[model samples]
Target: MAELLEQRSSISLQLIDALLEVFGEFNQLNIWSKVTKDDFTVKRFDLGNDSNLCCCQLTETAKSKLNFSSPKDCEGVVVKFLTFGDNGITDNGLSLADIVAVNTVLSINQISPKLLFANSKCYVHEYIKSRIYTFENDDNPEVVKCLARILAKFHSLDAPISNNAYKTSQKSYEDFFNRRKHIYGWGNTEATGQKYLKALENHPEIKEQYYDEFAKIDYHSEIVYVQNLKERLDSPIVFAHSDFNRGNRLVVKDSKDQLEKIYLIDFDATSMNNRGVDFGDYFSNYRHREDFANEGFPSDEDMALFLNEYREKCAQIFGTEFLDKKENSLEHMIDEAKIYTLGSYIGGTFFGLMWYQEAHDTGKGQYFLNVAKNQSRGYNRLKKRFIEDGTIPRILQMPK
Candidate 1:
């Protein structure tokens, strides 16, 4: 253990040096001597706390890397070095334009998650603002709207499929799903379900109804249902940012107290999937907490308007009929959206439950457990809605 830690430390130092050397040769920034060399504590906005800082990169380098030509350059550049336990850097140093492009794609796709800036070897992203507690008062609504607009504009850009190597992969979707399953692991669903079940068992009276609902479910049956549903859906597949959520979106507020811009970050989970997956993400993230019981997730009446705007934007870039026709196509899209929502809820909840127990036992953060609980609730509401609206039967009856 000691030797491994030392080796990691040495590698980190080497990486920092390499970054400095590369930036220096470009006449971008001067590398200062190492001021700190400890475990880098990952923070929300900045790089890890223990990251080595050098003079800011040259104005031109920063401008070129970020793809912005600032009239004035002030302050120094700080290069942060980070080491993941298992996941290596997926994206590294990126310019502002790269960040913008990423976010633009996400907004157009309605994919949300923390925005990540990356180069060929390293990844950079904005620090998280704060731990989110209540979505009600948070700037979520304006943020969603702004994201919708940005996504519309982004999808308006010519498709960059030629730039990505994975676009032509044969088993892209399967590979993508398997990778997610591995990263999430059995710890997300099975372990989590056991933990929550134990908790509910301990507090039977307080959580009786919740317990009863879960108790009636059969895990194997659920799994089979999902597998069968996947085989039945005939939605056309497109390149999608698979892990879309609010956490992935970076929201910037303007002076008018409205959300001005949204940046989509994180492409590690990017995949080719149904467009409905993106819609599911938008609905899942934007739904009202109270509406969870009724399966009436919240969306601004403007959501349709936003979709229409996105459609127009996509048409401009992808062609006049990029999406299906506006009228009949919208209705079909809504149905597909519902199906995708259910699929995501079920799949995500299962993963959550599997991981919950291990996370709790290992004293890992409570994040996994919270995700499990929230998604479980979402699944229940979605199922109920499907049953009540007769969608479940219709889905089951559909030809595979």
Candidate 2:
């Protein structure tokens, strides 16, 4: 652990130096406090607020050979420093294609802190540009509606083609998740399974499920089949937020305490896939277990509200009837849940079971560990019963 902390300290220092270089001496970024997100590096700092002004989000992976794009002004305001990943990221970094996809989505969504000059002459880091407000709860109704609306509109758009750039960009982003799973699972499924199984010595229920699923996967074959299913599916390719779970979406509230404009952050996992992929991630917390980022997943009422809202938005935006089809096909929902659950089980296992101890041992504390833990637990519980047993848990039931 000492070595781990030392490594983090070194990286932290490097980030400070880069920020110092960017912000300059006068309006130097001061690290007032640090907050933890489930899957990213975040630090909250006072950007020269004697009276505690709005906080600036300086979130970019700066632990590599950081390079900058030529600076540009937004609405006549010039940002002091705007660095791009350039060629800095060795194992994982943003690709030019990813940048274009993000910029494209920002335009399509008609949302902001909209891409402030996409592919700008090497600008690496993206900022919120305005004060970001917090949600009162994870299941804040406005956020739910906003999420559904954005997703419906997004799904209505055409997906990116499998060009070289598209492949390269998506590969880089997906690899970022894989590396963590590899390292945290101690580089392999057996080793990582051991780490999680050890942690679950007390919980036999999940232990049984873990062993059962792990036993079924050929990894290479099963994953390939799933990928093939995605490729061959007749479903339309749509834009996806990828990681649409908590901490990614932020908002600003009105004077009446209602949500005004909502924005989704962290486009690292953004890609074009079947709408089911987005829906799966959207309802990640719907299964059993505890510590969901939102308030214990969406209830039947909430799901109805969301889908009703999604239906309305899709009708308006795409002129297509999505959720309320003839026979109101539950088969599609079932198929989506299968597709989503399998992926979620695999990915959530990597985080909840394998990555929890790694994050905790390395000083990430409870939130990251809990995200890793609870997500796995919830998925496992849902997978064994909902996916395998065909039992519709409360959250999974559709409105009649």
Candidate 3:
């Protein structure tokens, strides 16, 4: 316990140094009324993948002016620290992109936590009261509809960002495996790879059925295939929160209406892509991580419920007969989302590999191993259904 406390103390000091660097000794920019050395407490915010990211909530210890439960109250700031790799450079490009994405979301009249300050070492955001949206325990269909409306609002944005959403998604998929080549020893001499392989030796089927089969095809080709299909079907390219999983979603209950309002956070992977990719990404993450519940993935009826609201919301927002045209009807978008679901499952398999690696490193035993297994199983199940429905070719043929 002594060692642990010492390590935490060291981390707290480092974070304090970073914050002081961003906001000078006297808090010249007036981010807070007064910036005292021991006026704030630092605690890590346990959200998102912590492997490469560091998020912390710095709460003021002094008295505040507003009520704690009010939606408008901001008692603290969430800080995302920049992690510098072996190479001297930091992930500033991604940080800048995220900042741009946050501004874009705010521009659309959507709710994103306000940005207080930013620098190369860390960026600070006004911390809003919110809890991560969990799809399992919070099984309110109204939440689903609200999420759909929020997503439509996002997709309707003509944000000034790269239009390479498809390429971006595919690249993310590839990067996962490339990372594993070293982190989990996919094709390297790293000793950690041996440990990874040894852990999964008993599950030979995972390699033969999922990883090996998954490795046989190029993901870029798969992206191309869907891109062509979406183009032929008139799928609009719009701003998308490419990583719109449930964890990135936050909820706060309105004190007046008592209805839950959705707030989206995290935009490191935002880009202009086919709207279906966002839907696919969102829908594929329905299952709970702990139990790996299968029922979490929305049913056809649930999809219809969400998509209908989305279609109408788009029509309302754009002031056109949006998606009501003969070619681009609600049904077509539903089918398109379904088609994109295949890509999501493929991504899920890659996520499973990542989870396994994280688990191995943290000595979490077979907890994440089961997560990987369930992910591969989910992907195969969805792929089988798609193949049987004649939605896609049995083999994801490389684009010519």
Task: Give the per-residue lDDT digits (tens) of candidate 2, residues 106-157.
Answer: 6566653544333332222234433333333434666777867876776666
- Find the 10 residues in a row with the least total lDDT in model 3: 1-10
lDDT, candidate 1, 303-368, per-residue tens: 465455556556666677666564225555555566667666666665555564445455542445
Model 3: residues >4 Å from true position, as ranges?
Answer: 1-10, 25-33, 51-61, 64-73, 83-98, 136-138, 163-167, 174-199, 202-234, 254-257, 287-293, 354-362, 393-400
TM-score of each: 0.59, 0.57, 0.74
lDDT, model 1, position 4: 10
Give the Cα error of residue 326 in candidate 2, in Å.
7.9
The predicted structure with the larger TM-score, 2 or 3, is: 3
Please list the residue runs of candidate 2 whose C-alpha ends up more than 4 Å from where it truly belongs after superposition.
1-94, 104-108, 118-143, 158-235, 286-301, 321-342, 353-361, 365-372, 387-400
RMSD list, candidates in order: 9.0, 10.7, 6.1
Superposition error at 214 for model 3 (Å): 9.2
Tens-place lDDT per residue, model 3, 1-400, is: 0001122354556666666555563244353435444545555555535422333333444434212433443456666666654543323224344455555555346556676665556666666666677754236778878888888888777665544445645466456556665465554434333435555555675555444433443434554555555555555667777677776777777776455677887666676666777877766765455434344456667678788888888889987666657535766676667667766665554555556766654656355655555655666677667678665552234232
lDDT, candidate 2, at 4: 12
lDDT of each: 0.47, 0.46, 0.59
Provide the clashing-pair count of each candidate structure: 41, 4, 0
lDDT of 2 at 278: 65
